[model samples]
Target: MTDSRATQADIAACVFDELKAIVANLPDVTGCAYERAPTDAQDLPCITMQTLDGAPVERRYLDGGRVANYRFALLLRKQDQEDQDRLDARALLERVASSLAEAHVELGASRAAWGMTLDTLPHRAEAGAGFADWRTELTLKYQTNR
Candidate 1:
């Protein structure tokens, strides 16, 4: 029997959903969404995630498992009252990283074995009037046979 591989959209959806769930329980995050947040949405701490890319790597014929490389970008926008902006952003980014590191089963549509790597540290930049942007990139190799 051949194992089914998840499509790009399916993998993206599962990752987005899992991020949403994880961010919901995180403190200081007002919302988490795929792509972008609504314009009319309140100016608060939020996380917006997007799939950068995914490409086929290799396949195991014996187990019918496929390997793929995926890249995801997480943009964390935080509104801070004081001058500890960079610190705040880094804190949130750390939390996000920790959550993702522990995330194996919640990765996506397929039953995947993940090897996650952080491609970049959170970069600090101005977002809007009082908001700061912390952008982080993560790379993952997902191997799934289910």
Candidate 2:
């Protein structure tokens, strides 16, 4: 018998939940949610996840499956000392990357059929006086049976 196929939403939710669980134990992570960044400064160092785009892998006569790209935004407040905030952001980024790498290996071994790839974008500080909004974009590529 063939394995049951999961819907795109199911796959997305699974990935998001896994990410949430991974980051929940990290230091300075104030919040995690599906879409919509937090408005309160207290919620700084928050992570917002969303499914950006997806498409099927092209192939003839075979179930090539679909690939979905998910985006995770890490937001943090700038400190009084610019260097300190930058350091904190970078530290957090490193931790996130490490966690994702480990998760990818574990998931790959256990799931076998599904696949995941993580692309970490450069961190940037948003404009606006007194607001040190350092943001990092993590692109997660997920594949599942079509």
Candidate 3:
């Protein structure tokens, strides 16, 4: 029962599919893919996906089970943190909740993700994100079928 053949592409596709299923399966999302890091260890794999506008959603897989825990990261511009942008996180949370509500049963197959943890960091000005200072990371652990 080993799923070792699962590629970064496979995990990313699942992430994209579940994420897109949120907000009514909108087509606004684009550029979804996983990046293989030479430094990544064998047991833990990761992937990153970006929206058409360049915003990103990232996930990292831990051990397999009924609930999977994934870290969803997002990089937003400093300007995007304006008062208007402050609501962005809440909105996204609501979207995720809606996704969970609509697909709870379907999510029975999630076998991954029990809860989520989120954090944000401000990038240095020299990092090319002169205007994009915020890096938000979310750790989502779900209910897996162990």
lDDT of each: 0.70, 0.54, 0.36
- For model 2, residues 56-121, the per-residue Cα lDDT tens digits are 232222564444444445554433257777777767765665575457522232223233444554
lDDT per residue, candidate 1, 44-86, as tens digits?
A: 6788887785444555546656676667788887775576866
What does candidate 3's lDDT look like per residue over 1-146, in tens digits? 22422422344455556644453343322222333212222311112333222222233335533333444544322223355544553354344444433452233344443444443342322122212223345444445333
Q: TM-score of every model?
A: 0.78, 0.65, 0.38
What is the alpha-carbon lDDT of model 1 when measured against the actual structure? 0.70
By lDDT rank, best first, the candidates go 1, 2, 3
How much is the lDDT of residue 5 in candidate 2?
A: 31
Candidate 2 clashing pairs, residues 3+ apart or interchain: none
Candidate 1: lDDT of 23?
87
Clashes in predicted model 1: 0
- The runs of at least 3 residues in candidate 1 whose Cα sits more than 4 Å from the true structure, single-residue gaps closed, are 1-6, 38-43, 54-64, 80-82, 107-110
Q: Lowest-lDDT window of 10 residues in candidate 3?
A: 37-46
